[model samples]
Target: MSKKQWPSWGHGEQAQQHYLVEPRALAGGGDVRHVHAFLRACGWRDKTQRGGPLALQSPDRTVRIEYQPAGMPGGWTIQGAAAPGRDAWWAHLGAQTPVEIVAGFTDALTQPRAAHAPNVWAPLREQRWRRPPETEHVTATSPDGSAWVQYRPSAGGGAMWWSGAQDRQGNGWVAQFTPSTPLHLVEAFTAALASPEPVMRPLGHVPHSARLRTTSVSVLPSQLGAWQQARITAARAATWASTAPRNARPRSTAARHHAPTGGARARH
Candidate 1:
């Protein structure tokens, strides 16, 4: 590349837009927008913008990089692009690595410009590195009518889900819950009704309500009892249905005064 002396502004200068940095040298203030566009293209956010030919000053030190703005009289000389007095080459320097000459006074700063890294972020790698755990296979209906599932590869016990399915480290399961959702027909039968005879099919009515929500329900071959079937149907239907209210006429317009068509009035 070639070195640039203190030069004036050039063409293609506009406002509130992004521009690109050509591989060659920049002429003036228009290069600032181009520099921003380039950094954004490379996935760098939280950038800093500087304008005019002031000495490169970072009182806050929060600035990761610096550049000039568009449409101003003083263009730039990045790494000191087209700076007023001093040579721009001072920016192209580093302890070892070199700063890229974006424009006159313009530069794409790398490391050493930044001070240090944070502590909390030390544990996580830059990218997603490992996969999640697997699900175990110990799911069954509970005696108390609530769901009962065991997670596997666990040292006898692990985090459990209501849905009953689990693996050692993979995704989890989801179980149904209600004020009164039962796992077995026996639970519903006991809650809904009492009978002296043995239960052939699950006594469905024994449970008063299926406090839990259900999408659909059907009688199984094993659940061939009359009372159990009735309880299931009633629970499924007990949901609130949405409906719109009737449109009403305004109260002021509801009534009107009437005048007599044929008039005949006399007083005695």
Candidate 2:
């Protein structure tokens, strides 16, 4: 995708920037490496064996992330331990879920934020999702009503708190977030779902079921190469900064100038 094809941001003058009427769906299984990079940046430890699925644990052991290629239930699983006045939570991304969409959850997880309850339905609402009066559920459906998101509040005992399905024929993918999951995380996920930014996928990689909802565009191979390189560079920089010593300081110019003099001052 070219720079001009990228989505615009903000409102008014900024909104005037040319934006695609429909989002482009890119090809490829969601990249797990990006998730790993974000976790590493936030002090999470990798515990994957040579041939095992990817696994990571938080510095405090309060959160866990795992990615299974087989994806019997879900390919990506993230869990948080119970905290003060808050219950334990789990989120799952199906194997077919897009990396850009999955990144929304991980990105929000790594960000620093004040403690407050976020309105999980706000993003969906802004996108014209319907909430029946006095009901606990909010729903958003695709134009053809094939794909939809159903959000149920205060669900209990193995009930799905958030459920998303991509096709009516049961051939597409599904994702779920369990009860007590962080609202902000769900908000981020919904925001990403409602975002106008196109997801770049190769023509061959785009799913047959989702083609109707996506716009076909000629994305250069170099664009994917550059995108991957930029992500690698950012992840490396973040890792370096995170691991740097807090107490370390650079030598002053005076110290550099006096290095050859040892403890004695040179006579002028």
Top candidate, metric TM-score: 2
Error of 2 at 167 (Å): 2.3
> Compared to the true structure, candidate 2 yields what TM-score?
0.68
Q: How does candidate 2 score on lDDT?
A: 0.59
Every model: Cα RMSD to truth = 35.8, 13.3
For model 1, what is the error of residue 93's alpha carbon versus the real structure, in angstroms, after optimal superposition?
13
Candidate 2 lDDT trough over 10 residues, lowest sum:
256-265
TM-score of each model, in listed order = 0.16, 0.68
Q: Candidate 1 overall Cα lDDT vs. reference? A: 0.24
- Model 1 per-residue lDDT tens digits across residues 166-267: 223322122222211112211221211111111111123111222221111222222222233333232222211111122532333334322211010111
Stretches off by above 4 angstroms in model 1 are 1-26, 29-31, 47-63, 69-268
Report residue 18 deviation for candidate 2 (angstroms).
21
lDDT of each: 0.24, 0.59
Please, what are the lDDT tens digits per residue for candidate 2 over residues 19-121? 1223322223445665676667666789888988889887778888888878477578889999998899999877766666677787677665548778766
